[model samples]
Target: MAITIELDDAMASQLRSEAAARQMSLEEFGRRLLAEAMHRIQVSSNWRARNQRRVELIRKSTSAELTAAEQAELDDLQAELYERMETADQDLLDRIADLENTVMP
Candidate 1:
């Protein structure tokens, strides 16, 4: 899947300058960037797969046929977990946004 693309002189110069500043050859710098990008994509995919499995397990467990008493108890627990997760999500989002605002221009 290797594709050849031409970079105008300005962009090529910029990349060369960046590589030089980092004490890396341009080829090595590009290779490192590509590796990092691939690693990020892989990590993201793994996280998504794990999360999907977790959701599926939760759904299967929750929807099983069970005695009424057991079901009621499970329902109560699930409701509590849902509420806590919702609150945590909001708190996490607020913290992330606050941190971004503080660190980013």
Candidate 2:
């Protein structure tokens, strides 16, 4: 697929600088950026879907009983969700520290 976009001068300059720093063509860098974004979107979508299923399973368990397999799946989903939350929290803290250092230095 081919697409053309008109970027404002600042954005264009930034992208060009980044591509040069990476020793890549602007088009290749743009493609890589888009691919990374799409991958993140897909990962987020899958996480949401898993979370929905986990909620449903929890509701079912509260009202009735889960099979052994269902219980295992719920446990796995809960663990994964907790880990992701922890990672996100740490990332936020790291970014905040970076900003503070830049501002205070």
TM of each candidate vs. truth = 0.48, 0.85
Which stretches of candidate 2 lie above 4 Å from their native place? none
Best by lDDT: 2
> Model 2, range 82-103, lDDT digits (tens) per residue?
9999999999999999999999
lDDT of 1 at 24: 100
- Report the C-alpha displacement of residue 17, candidate 2, in angstroms: 2.6
* Candidate number achieving the greatest TM-score relative to the actual structure: 2
TM-score, candidate 1, is: 0.48
lDDT for every model?
0.77, 0.97
Candidate 2 lDDT score at position 16: 98
